[model samples]
Target: MTSIFDADGKQVPCTVIEAGPCVVTQVKTLEKDGYTAVQLAYDEKKEKKTTAALAGHFKKAGTTPKRRLVEFRYFEEDKQQGETLTVELFNEGDFIDVVGTSKGKGFQGVVKRHNFSGVGGQTHGQHNRLRAPGSLGASSFPSRVFKGMRMAGRTGGDRVKIQNLRVVKVYPEQNVLVVSGSVPGAKGSYVIIEK
Candidate 1:
């Protein structure tokens, strides 16, 4: 994440994303694959780390092995296999949706996960019950703690889609895009951008 100065001299917060020079690995057709979509590959990877089957797949595309492969449905343009896509696909002031995995906060309690107030005021022999999740349910009727109850459990590390982020800048030469607001995932993690 970084800050950029706009025309009015106001500092705007944004996230710089590598918009790719992604290779088109495959093109699915309605008759052949029962769907229409374009599969794109990004980021270079070592042959030693790539499986033989995947290596052959990349070889068919006339490109080296890529670390990430994503399929985009409903692509408007006519793109063939082995074609490269860059930041020129987007323009300044355009709104796009970014999808990525959020950071993992393993084993979080209700106080942080569900934003519970933590049993209210800490009084009346409430020593360590401040951050505890109050109660489950009735002890007898429908005993089994009812499904879909919000409680302490694993949190984060989920696929999150942030919609309608404006494109602040586009550097086609470097295949980079600067979008307004924060993006999910840690640094260097791959994100899928959709218009």
Candidate 2:
């Protein structure tokens, strides 16, 4: 492996990975389980919030209560028994897709959110109607406005997928994964990236 270094030959690009000592909360098999995937839970919290049933589920796996749990399409070849997956799972220059929730921009106009040309007028006495949608309803046919119309409603704060972001570096010791482009959500949001 080539040494990941910065301009001064210091390792800068290496991302800090906060991988667990995660617990195998649940295991899926082909027979009764009907699938082959392991549910891993990271960032454990107190037992109070977790129910006795769910707590016992984690207990059976030899792990404590966790805040978040996710299941992936697990294959036998990619399986590593009792080992944790960290930032070291990725190498430099690997292309990955990042998925996260985008920042919420509440009740945005068409021009801002949907990029519609709003009632085009800088000429004839344009007053306040600049950002308005011209005609929401057609006069004769289709009396009521169609459903799923792109009107001024809740914008952003949705699941966003950014494709082909180059993995610049991965610092397994620090537990961070830094990609080439911007990610969704705020500064400290959980994002899942896959190959």
Find the candidate with the highest lDDT and give its number: 1
lDDT of 1 by residue, 26-67 (tens): 999999999999999999999999999999999999999999
Clashing pairs in 2: 15-170, 15-171, 15-176, 16-174, 16-175, 16-176, 17-175, 17-176, 18-175
TM-score leader = 1
What TM-score would each prediction reach against the true structure? 0.96, 0.82
Candidate 1: regions farther than 4 A off: none
Put down candidate 2 lDDT per residue, 71-165, tens digits, no spaces.
76653345433345556767878898878899998988888888988887678887888888778877678778889877888899999998897
For model 2, the superposed segments whose C-alpha errors exceed 4 Å read 1-21, 74-83
Q: Residue 91 of model 2: what lDDT? A: 81
For residue 163, give model 2's deviation from the true position in Å.
1.4
